[model samples]
Target: MRFTTIGAAIVDIVVARVRPVLGAKQDVDHIGLYAGGGAVNAALNMAALGGEVSIHACVGRDLEGGLIRDLLQRHHVRADIPDHTLPTGKSVVMVDESGAARAYAQRGASAWVGEQGFQGLDQADVVYVTGLSLKSQAWLEQALSSMETPTFRLVVTPGARQLSHPQALEGLWKRADLLCVNASEAARLCDESVPDADAVSVEAAESLARKLVRRPGQHVLVTLGAAGAVFFDGAQECFHAARPVTAVSTIGAGDAFASTFVHAWALGDSAQNALARATDSAAGIVQVIPANRAGLLRKL
Candidate 1:
């Protein structure tokens, strides 16, 4: 199946287990640069899994953009990305000893992508959109208003920041056939006070899922990290526990799950089977630091 993903294409400078003092430089156990961003990561995952994938996120005509393009080509993923005058987007990701990651980002060229970027939407069987793409009003209209209903399978994976402002993407989610989010993002979308994945009880998470289902047949999937994920479709609901693994980094785990799930489901896997596939894929990603396309391919 052909998949098109639209959102940010960023350069991630990942640092592992480094604690810094205000004015001094510190040594790190590991530091590497990789191509990243929700859309970029998801597209690469689908490509590695043998799907024909194309990405439409904006990049700049700079070293960072060149890096992103080269990585995409090496992975066999098609790049439909356009170059911008601004620098390419970037993020500095810091991973602690516990394998948790935090990021400081500059949206850069990604922030400038608008309606013109949606020109080739009809070329794919499935169109996957990340939260980063919906921030522009013109792009949002092109995606939701200008397009026909149910032209292709629409899968949405809104990040925590987008979920924080649910009102902005309300219409888009309502129109989506599949909506994917982690426990924290789900809680935020539902206006619930879920502090973390563990704190989100299955019942509470299921309740949040029900609230997120905008239509009768729409699927709302809430992933709870190692707890796995919960799926609700207004009628049926199921919880799948994650396979156990020692995590190297939790970064991009959610993106792995979303793309894997979409790939499996599009290939005719049952919802339960798709959830299992996603959980297993995410488990592998967590075991690799950076969890970008090359790392995932290496793990494979």
Candidate 2:
């Protein structure tokens, strides 16, 4: 299972506490720091699951960048760190007692990845692209065009900014073999508000999956929080149920799911088996408290 993931790498500074949903200021019960970034997290997860994973992304010249690289290497992930002077990406993740989180993301060196950074894509069996590193249409086109391998599978996970540009996203969607998104992103692409306004609803997930699967050369996967996920592969549809768990933080669950799914799928697992594996992995992530969360990229 040779997999390549392209996106930003960030240090996640997480603070967890028991506080009301709305407040001016609250006391933090604990704080934890972890290597984080959409693509990096996925790459780490894939490697942890015994896949041969390589990361194609940029990091800063700062200590945070060093930390991110060290962490990936510790997880046995091959990394292609480009030279950049910008600060490494960073995120502040706050988790309430209810296991819900809000994140403030700052893209630093991640935005500097360009055509020169995408030179090694042809060596991968599967390629993953996230909206985090794709800032412009030119960058997306250049990255995709650089792939010379006819059998390379392309997986696209649109970031928040990419959701605002429907035409550009649709263009990229056509080139992707797999498209994974949350309910909000799916609704944003369709130019309509999702029914029931809940990401975990079957209606919203299935609707979004259907819309994306209709695109040429794309299989759609919609992740529904604790409800698990749904995959639409043209003529067939597959669903997996989430495992019951007491969650401590849900911040990294999506990344965990996407990476696990890709790893399983790349290994030729059926859609049902892949989804089940992904759900179990995500459930393990959500149960870990921030301060006690260690070896996040290690095999379970």
Candidate 3:
């Protein structure tokens, strides 16, 4: 599949063996810099799965931007990054001994990508919009309107930013061919019946997905890490159970699932089969550290 992704491209600085405690001096285990961001990760995953992928995002003319470009080229994914005044986006990630990570993000140049990114949207088989890119709400609305004929598939995956803006997200949700989100994101987007955002039941996920499906043919997916993922169309509901695996890190597990699901479904797999494929792909992702690395998820 030929895929075009619109979203953030960030450089992640990871420091392992750091405690969340305020002021405690401890020896660090390791430190590394890697390519990250929702769109960047998704693009890398798509390329790893043998899909022809291209990314539209902005980055500054700096060392970080050079690194991002290098990573994309190494993976055979085409990148369309315009020069910006602000430095490239970055995240300071602190990983505790237990493998849980806390990140502080600076959007920087990622917030703007200009109108050039939308020029050849109809030419690609799939155009996946990640939540971080939704920061350009006005531009996104305009782009969606211009593609009214729906010549290509549209898949949306919401992040914290998109979920915070109900009206904008609702507008995009109505037009999306496939809307994918993790269980926690689904809980936040759903009604008050879902009190806990971290732990959402399959029934609640399905209900939440059902409510979000505005059109007859739209598909909504709620992914439950480790447990499984729930798929809901206007008329059908399907759940795929996850396989057990020892996880090294789960930072980009959802991205893996979303990319794989879209890739599989777009290639004519049944919804249930696609969900199973996605589940297996996510299982592979969690087993690797620095989850955003390209080539981590191969065809299973």
Candidate 4:
């Protein structure tokens, strides 16, 4: 299927084996730079899974921008990056020995894409909007208006960005063909009876999915890391349990799961097959570095 991922593209700086502290220093195991961003990772994941994907985002006219373009091009994802004077957005990620990571982000060019960036958003079979890109209500409106005809499936994953302004994205719950959120985001969107964000269980997933607008071509998929994922439409719910694995880096697991599920579903796989594809794809990604799915999820 033709897939278009809309949002940010960032250069990620990762330092290994460092215990983050305010005033103290720790030994670093390793350091590296990689291409990342919600849009960047999701688009690359689709391309890796054999989907015709394109990325519509913004980047700076700097060295990191060149790296972003090259990385996207290498994976055969058409890169539609708007040029900006600001340095490309970047994230400084610190990882410990146990594979957990903390990141500090600079929006830079990513937050400046604005409405003009939505031009390349059309002509795709599936359009996925990174909720992290909701810096402009106008951009979201442009995206919503594009769905007036319903020619393509609109998938929204409105991470923490939506949580901060739940009212602004209320329209998305109605328009998005599929809504994918982690357990915490779901818990915040529900009424008082829902499970707590800390307790990300099937009950929480189900509760959050039920609160979503019931419309044609609607679905809610909630990812719970090792707890697996839950899929709920209006009628029933399906849960997929995760397989255990030692994680190398948890960075791109969600992107892998989201894109793989969309790819498999677009290929006419049954829901069970799609869920399995997503779960296995996520499991495989955490066992390696470099979130590119070519070596990680392609052969799966």
Candidate achieving the largest lDDT: 1
Give the per-residue lDDT of model 2 (tens digit) for 197-288: 23457766786788766466568888877777888887667888889899888877888888888888878899999999989888988887
Clash pairs of candidate 2? none
Tens digits of lDDT, candidate 4, 27-75: 6767777887888888988887888998778899998898888878878
* lDDT of each residue in 6-36, candidate 1, tens digit only: 7888888888886655656878788888888
Regions of model 1 farther than 4 Å from truth: 19-23, 295-300
* Candidate 3 structure quality by residue, lDDT tens digits, 120-182: 777789989886655475587687787668688889887788887767788878888999987
**Superposing every Cα of model 3 onto the true structure, what RMSD results?**
3.6
Estimate the TM-score for candidate 4: 0.90
Count of clashes in candidate 1: 0
Q: Which 10 consecutive residues of model 2 have the lowest summed lDDT?
A: 291-300
lDDT of each: 0.81, 0.76, 0.80, 0.76
How many backbone clashes can be found in candidate 2? 0
TM-score of each: 0.93, 0.90, 0.92, 0.90
Candidate 4 local lDDT, residue 140: 63
Predictions: Cα RMSD each: 2.9, 3.4, 3.6, 3.8
